[model samples]
Target chain A: MSTATPVTAGADTAAVRQAIATTARPPRPGPLSTALTFGWRGMLKVKHVPEQLLDVTVTPVMFLLMFTYLFGGAIAGSTSAYLDYTLPGLLVMSVLFTTVYSGVSLNTDLTKGVVDRFRSLPIWRPAPLLGSLLGDSVRYVIAGTVIIVVGVALGYRPDAGVTGALGALALVVVFSFGLSWVFSVLGLLLRSPNAVMNAGFMGIFPLTFLSNVFVDPATLPGPLEAFVNVNPISILATACRSLMDGTPDGEAITTSLVVAAALAAIFLPITTRLYRSR
Target chain B: MTTHAPLAIEVTGLEKSFGDTHAVAGVDLAVPEGSIYGVLGPNGAGKTTVIRMLATLIPPDAGTARVLGHDIRTEGDAVRSLVSLTGQLASVDEELTGRENLILLGRLLGLSRSASRTRADELLEAFGISEAAARLVKHYSGGMRRRLDIAASIVVTPRLMFLDEPTTGLDPRSRGQVWEIARALQAGGTTILLCTQYLEEADQLADGIAVIDRGKVIAEGTPGQLKASVGTGGLKVRLLDPGQRGDAAGILERAVGAVVLDADPAALSVSSADASRAADGVSALARAGLGIAEFSLGQPSLDEVFLALTGHLAEERDATLEEQSS
Candidate 1:
């Protein structure tokens, strides 16, 4: 007998199996409690497999460092001045790119049947999906914080104090939350993880780069400029800029919020319904 | 507990479809309380599909079921509360250490943090993986991972368990270990619904067995009854001399009072309704001076039973999938 044998042998197997019926039923926890349990489990994933944090943490650090020095002087005349402009867009890009993870992790769970046990449990059926979305949002917040702190360190200053910086971060985090549903849809629709990543690359690039995130819309050709001026990514960067520069643009902020809300209203149902039907 | 036990599982006309293919056409089952029921089938025979419906993982398109006397359709929560499932794919988190997996399961079941930790420790020790409790399950061997998975399911010691191919991919030794665990669970008064492609597994473990093919229950009975339905136990005889084959066949058939199913050049076999008729054949052969190389009586092979119940051999899978997919 091994060390584990005695503990198991001491229990009466029949009594234990029947004990579920004899004992008082444990009160069922709310969906939030169940969801957070899974959310906490998701957070631990970045701990055990630290590589999962690369997209959120290391990418922000690397992008802020690279884009600030290389494109800064060329675009804005001085590296320090360019840091002010590029930092906002770079923050948006880093957080936006981190949304790819929601899709990847969700696809991994559904395809590998990782949540199969959760599906059979007595807990709220939607908890895993809700938890997964929340867990990914937490990752986005971490990425956003990294971008802003690194941006500040690189001579980029926000005219808006802590309050404005917090507001800007909140808006971006909510936008990232909505954008995650799109990737979540892709995660469910596509079977291959590689396909999900490729789709993210193809879809996210044109939206983020074609926008005025990196350069002024006034510097672009007429057609490209028109697209950039109306791009949702551009609206997001503009809102964050106004908030950070202490000159808030009400229309930009409203439009960005509206777009994020629309994305969530449409895709959230589709993702949840597809998930439940499975 | 009531003096009169209810059927642990009862269903009627369960149906489900994926696209044009009917994954489970229409299934009905009644499993006795505290008895092991086996659903035996080949790949794509809808064993997993039926189990999923019963386990409440997927809703059936039509029909209904009551598990532990609770309707699966309307009272899925009640049904789920009582039944635990170890799915075809081991559903434990690969990223979590074994201890974390158990703790998470406990927390979901409403155990407090300290209680969950205590329960997790108990389960780990019970499953004999206490030493590896802190190790990530991805690093565990196939046997250790599955043991821990089963251990996790018993966190509250569910009264009814659905084991969907609990030993599908393990080696013989690991398979034996899993079998022991399943037996222990059953001995603890758990009603088990076991689905497997391994006929030997069902035969050894299940008190009653159902042979499913193309999403339908083609045959259902005790293993003995099913095996007997395939035309009785078989009697095989091999002679030392090939020339004596015909003579041996006649003497044995006359001695055993059965028709010879096959007569090869040097060997002969017959259906023995009374498997013990081999004893009669032995004396008759000795009396006839025919040197017997071998003589044995055995029940029909499960494959033969499957072949008898369904037209094709059990291993030959459904060709309809290709037709439906195309």
Candidate 2:
């Protein structure tokens, strides 16, 4: 950070230009380096504009507190019983909702022409999109941490201890990463950030509400209740709940992993293709 | 005066269209190594589309181009390696500081951590943005952001650069600064394909200019050559007395050999092959006993050449394009 002798535009530029030309672009960087370079770029955004973390921090904690206090009595006949059932579901919801930011961020970057600048560079072409997806993992982790701490403070305990908690957290993060690819496509296709956000909410809100996030799937109406049972959100919620409660449901966990893997397989290529063509 | 310099860019019959709009209709150009080639046009004249094609940001749809000897379509990665593009606006990340943007670019260019850090510092100071290097690009002035934008591209000083309207939306002072940057880069043996709407910019910076209009290169030459192409500088004669106007006009026509056209009611103008011819015409009118109030030589402006080539003012042509797009 210290300043060396300031070289103005008119200074000894010949040597600088020569050095740059002869540098030979340093052996084509591997894909990991390219992705990390862009990942570092995305991480800087969260560092500089920490307020970007508001969704992961304030929103999740508020949802945890509101859900536990407001609906605990009606749903479980007591707040403590409700806390155990709802906390895992709420964790899934928080991470799911946080995926919207990925879409919004990509749309904003495109509109600003930053993505165009990245496109012109000689680095691995898909790095920007991949790095952005990886960077959003930070948000998922933050949301998970906030919800866990808040839930623990409100007298909820994870029966499966650190191993179970880590497993469940991994599932949530992986699920969100795959989900981000879907939003990345939305970001690439949408004309504006607001439109991306609105579309994202429209797609996400109903799934989260209709799934077994807040209530037991059995109590719902006929067809709507059937839809909730099969929803990915419900599958994820069941997986996380079982893992955190010391009884990892192999069937539920397999379904969540396969669904996440499927989301990524389906959307990653689609997003990358749309991004390059643009 | 002749030296074997490799062509920095050689492109032919390039074509691109957005739906029905032909953004770049068949075009050809050869930019000399270490020279600044200007692409002059009004807005939406396909200037950007051509630069994009050469810079490997997009495909040309038809035709072939090689940048620094690498093909644009098949060898696009190679094309991108040797060139950098700073688009019309400062296509830089505003979220990061100038320093961070530079470092990021350097890292992407495959520089090591310490090397990129050193290079970033060197470029920050070189572009005169050292003091504001830590400030976010959003906080930089229009001029500062542009300087950083160009600086970022040089993290691995590209052998060729595509600067699309680098001075647009800038104040006169900033425009001059950007021009200075272009000059400095050219001095460093960089080939520049500069696209601009300002005739003066092309005149000042371009070693060769391609004046494009309606998705084609209407004309191409150096500033002096393009001007001279319209015609040799004109000769205008004004008679002091209205009575002698007819006689003066007649005498000047025979003197200059070219037909004299009435520039207005009071003045007669004709093309002169050179300054000496205008000088001779003036004296001939004097010897013919014609009282001339004032006579002057006029050199054709680039606007006049543009008008002749396009059949309308550049502004009018750009307006038409805008109207069509809207």
Q: Evaluate candidate 1 by giving its C-alpha RMSD to the native, one decimal.
A: 5.2
Candidate 1's residue-wise lDDT over A62-128, tens digit each? 7677766888788889888888887778778888988988898888887656666887899988788
| lDDT value, residue B286 of candidate 1 | 87
DockQ for candidate 2: 0.30
Q: B1-326 in candidate 2: lDDT tens per residue?
A: 24378899998999987777787889999889999999988788888888878877778789999899999899988888888889766888999998999998888888888988988888777677888988889999888888888888788878899998898888887788788778878877789999988777888899999999878899988888877676776777777776777777677777775545454667777654467877888899888887788877776444455656776656533444422221
**What 10-residue stretch in candidate 1 chain A is worst by lDDT?**
A7-16
Model 1 off-target regions past 4 Å?
A: A1-24, B1-4, B231-302, B316-326
Query: What lDDT score belongs to each candidate, Candidate 1 first?
Result: 0.80, 0.82
